[model samples]
Structure formats: C-alpha cells, structure tokens
Target: MQFMEDLKHLLDISYPIIQAPMLGVTTPAMVAAVANAGGLGCLPLGGLSPEKSLALVKETKAKTSKPFAVNLFAHSLTSEVSEEDIKIMENYLEALHKKYNLPFEHKPISSYRFYNHHDQIDILLDEQVPIVSFTFGLPEAQILSQLRERGVKAIGTATSIKEAALLDKAGMDAIVVQGIEAGGHRGSFIDKEPLPQVGLISLVPQVVDTVSVPVIAAGGIFDHRTIKAVFTLGAAGAQLGSYFLAAEESAASEVYKERVLSSTDTSTELTQAFTGKWARGIGNSFMEEMKNSGLVIPYYTYQNSLTAALRDFGKSGGIADIISLWAGQSASQSKSGSTEALFNKLIQQIKSDTNPIF
Candidate 1:
C-alpha cells in the first residue's frame, strides 16, 4: 500500500504505469495521450540536437498540462572512427546499397556529433519540465540538484543492482530497472566490460530491496499480467515500450510496426551493427551482413548517422529487410489502438479482481 501511494505521489500519476521513452519511435501526441490518461509519459530526446529537443518538449507541453518526463542519451560521442575504419564499413555496405539501388557513400565524419546531453539539460531547465530521465549513465549530481531545486524529478535507468544503487546514491527521485528482456538500447553504463543480463522477474525485487527510491520495472512487460508480476516483485511501477509501438500517435512506419507485430519472443538479437551500440532489434539483412562482415564504427549518434538514410529510404519504400524493427521479447503480444484506448484496457486489467493487490 505504501509503495503504491509513494509512486503515485512521487510521479503525480493515478496509475502505476509509465510510457517508456522511445527515442525516435514515439510522437508528441503519444506522450500527451499517456499523460492525459493519468500515467507518466516519457519523451526520449536522443539523436536530436538541443534545439530540436527543446522544440519537441514544448510541443508535448502544448498538448497536455499534466506532468511528463523528457529523457536523453547519456552517451559520450568521442568520434573514434578513423577514415580507414569508415572505409571498411562503407565498402561492406556498398554492395547491399547498390542491390537496393540507393546511392551509396560514407557519410562525412564531420556529419556526426555526439554530446553527453549537457545542452539538453539546459533545455529541460528552460522548459521547466516536470521530470527528466537519463539512460546509458547518470547526469552530474549538481544537475540533479538543480532539477530538484526547480521541482523537476530526476530519474535514471539501471540494468543491474549496482547501477541502481549508484543512481540511488546519486539521489535520483526514481530508478528504471531495465532487465535483459527490454527492447532497444542496453542501458548498462557502469561497466566497460560485457554487462550481465538479468531478467525482470529476478531483477526488480533485488533493485527494490537495495534502493530507497522507487523502482520502475522495464523489460518485456506487456499486458497487466506482467505489470502485476513486476509490482508483486516489489517494483513500484511498470514501464512499457513496444506495447505502444502501434499506437495511432506513434511515429513508427507501417513496415516497422508489421515486423514488430510478427516477431517472436526469440526473434530479437542484441547487435551493435546499426548504431555501434548494443540494442535489441529484429534481425534483418543489414544486421546479418554486418554480423558476418565484422565491422564496428563510432558509438551511437555517430554510427546511427551512417545508416539514417537507408532506414529513411526503407521506410519510404516499405522495405523491411534494410530497416530496424525494434521490439522487446514480448513483441508478438502487442496490440494496435489509440493510446487512450490502450491505456483504458490496461486500466481494466489493473482494476481486475484477479489482481489481489492494488
């Protein structure tokens, strides 16, 4: 009872659900819809410049008066890709690019720039966002202090117990415990080594036990069953991503949505080929070819720019093989509907008498 009340109080939400931030896939309307439905809506600001990030935040605020979170990638864009390195990746993709008959060339190294979201924090402050979340790593303690001074709640993503403890020690208002079953980018930041994959069922309880702040469980969570399970595991709230990929307000292409809908629990793989960062997505031609070619480039933002054109072209042409179909292990369980309608269904499940705990 205290957990439920504490979460609702902390997030200013009616339900213990959060619309997990999807960097490029979610839309302002989708964020607003979740906010309007009384759940926290998180808008991911990765891959966009600070100016663009602020514009998107203002747009979402214009659509809803309720509180919403704005998330940014905490990755450093060091630009370690040498010209020779670019040649290897480009030469490899050239053949496939011609097979698809799209102009093939390496994007200029000058085209890519990555920052650790410092400017984005300034934008969030200027916009007076109600909540801010960081993935990949935590922001500076002073930044969190500033946000708290301005009444902005700080949230961070943790893939392991130690990561959660770090965020808790950093004094974040909440920590999103992202298990291995989660789709999209791996939020493991503390270790430069291969991070151990922990499942949601096992991860949430341990994180909750270790942290004084609220724990929001994110992974292969779908319908209310998984949500209840997380809550029972001691998570204060649930965070879902693929569940809304097909929402009318989402920006995902038809091809992407179709692929997400058709994927099996075992169809997804964690590959760094697309963005030079390990992220879970359905296997495709590009993923397969990159896997066999043994090419690695600059980390995300930089690496993501190299494939931006192909993904755009594939989306426009309804070609699924060349584009990413980002989804969680429970991709096949997702349904299409308006965000409001989906939230209503989720609420019905939450209110079910079958769930003995509220």
Candidate 2:
C-alpha cells in the first residue's frame, strides 16, 4: 500500500489509480463512479468553453466529494484556416462525405478560440479543485507558480524523458509518462519527430530515473499485472483511458462501444485523419478510404473541425465507421460494465496480487 500511500498524500485518493482524462468520452457519471470507488477520476476540459468548463466542475463536485482532476489542452491559439485551406480540406472530404452519405454542405467554421488555461486555472482555483493536469505543452511560469501558491497539485503529460524533466523544472507536481501505446493524440512535448516507440515497462522506469518528481505510468496499461509492473518500475500511480470507454457510464456512443468490443488484434491504427494530429483509433472505413485517397489534411484542431459534421452524423445515425474510436493497444481487453463494477474488479485484482499470504 506504500504506492497508494504516496499517491494519496499527493492526489488525495483512496487508491493510487487515476482514470485517464479522456476528452469527449469521460462523462460525469463515469467520473463520479471512479471517485466513489476510491480512485481519482478526471474530467477533461480541453474542448469546453470557460462557462461550460465551470459548469462541468460544478456538476462533478455535486456528484462526488472525493478529489478529482481536470485536464486542459495547453496549446497556443492560431487563426482559423484561410479560405483556400478550407476549400482544400472541403474538396478532400467531399468524396468521402458523399461516399458515406454524410452532409456535403461545409458547416460555417466557428471563430478559432484557444483554450485560456489561465482563465480555466482561475476557475479551478476558485473551485479549489484538488488537482489540475495538462497535455500538449507546459504552462507559463506564472501559471505554475500560482497553482503551487494556491496548493493545487499540477501534473503534466510527456511523451519523452526530456519532456518529463522539463515538466519537473516547470514545477509540475508529477509527470504522466505517456508511452507510444497511449490512445488519442500523442502528447509530444519537445520532439518534432517521434521518439523511439518506448513501451510502458521501459518508459516508466526511465522517466522515474530522469525526473525528480513522481512518475505516473500511462499507455496500454489495463490489468493489475501492468499496474504492478509500473509500481515496481517506480511509478507512483497508473492512469488508464481506453478501459473506461467501455464502462457503461462512459459517454462514448453505443456504436463506438460495439466497434471496440468487436475489434480484432489488427483492428487499431495510428492515423491523423480525424484530428489531424496522430492518434490511435479502431481502423474503420473512413481510415481505409483516407489511405486510399492519400490526402493528409491540416493539424489536429483544424482537421477535427473539418470532420466535425461527419463525426456528428456518424454518432446520430448509430454508425461507428466514421467516428473516431480512440483506444490504446490493450483496447481489446476492455469489458463493458458499470464504472463501479469495473473499478472494483480492477482494485480487487490489484489487492489480491499484492497481498501477502500469512
């Protein structure tokens, strides 16, 4: 229990486990279930407006008094694409839209708005949320200092040891060592090209050795064996995302859940078709079509917007082929159940393995 002890003092959790802050998938019910089950549940605020983010925070608080974390996308804001860029993307998506019987009319782009980490930070401080975490990049010195000043624990995601050290230097309370096996967008902090695809077993210990702060292991970690491995490697806790996608309380669409459950060993791939940034998801018709068409669109947020209508259409029509079924390599291990049941099962398994026979 020493591993859980360390994490509890830092994150105020009854269990060392923390649910990964899954954007667009983790629901209030999911978060509450995890918290109620003694692990820290994270609610992602990456895509929400400031007001909406505050409302979510309030709703989460209403559901559970146990500590939780809120995650934000710490990226710089850029202009909406030029007319030419939009047209280019539109043309590329046109054939696929028609093929999929999706909406062809280009929806008017919302004025590009960047996540105001500062404003969200202020909101967190006001709410006195116990933990705040970020991905994509680190915050300004002032932001780090302010969080520390207010006693809010801050964690950052890193895809490399260098990024982990940088996060420690930037005053992060802990660093999530996001291995290559992680689902969704890759949180490459410094490197332009991908780092050697380090697995969790190797990456966690390396990051722990490099950084002075606590290392939380992520990526493809599903069962108690993987959890025990990370702890043995010196990770203070384990963060999991893909498993929650199948939790009954998860906000993931029914179609998305079915696709994940039906996935074979070769079902997933890393592609940037949906969000522009490289992310792992179940290989589907859209991904196959993109490969055949051979068109790489803009970076994440932009491409995400471009495919927004398609994703919406897929969701509304109960079609899983067009939606992004974000998941990790161990996604095949996911079993559909209530969040409480899943959390208890995982916790029980960890306890049984770690317990000493008299």
List model 1 lDDT by residue over 1-358, tens digit each: 6887798898899888999999778889999999999999999897578878978998999999999999887766663557777777677667667888888766677775665677678888888888888998877878888899999888899999999998999999999999889889989987566775899888999999999999999999988888888888998899999899888888989989988878888989888888877888888888887888766665666567778778888989999887877888988887889999988798887788564556
- At residue 67, candidate 2 shows an lDDT of 88
**Top candidate, metric lDDT:** 1
Tens digit of per-residue lDDT, candidate 2, span 126-161: 999989899978888898888899898999998887
Best by TM-score: 1
For each candidate in the order shown, give its overall lDDT on alpha carbons: 0.85, 0.82
Candidate 1 RMSD to the real structure: 1.5
Off by over 4 Å in 1: 105-108
Go through the candidates in order and give the C-alpha RMSD of each one to the true structure: 1.5, 2.3
Instruction: Please report the TM-score between candidate 2 and the true structure.
Output: 0.93
CA shift of 326, model 1, Å:
0.8
C-alpha TM-scores of all predictions: 0.96, 0.93
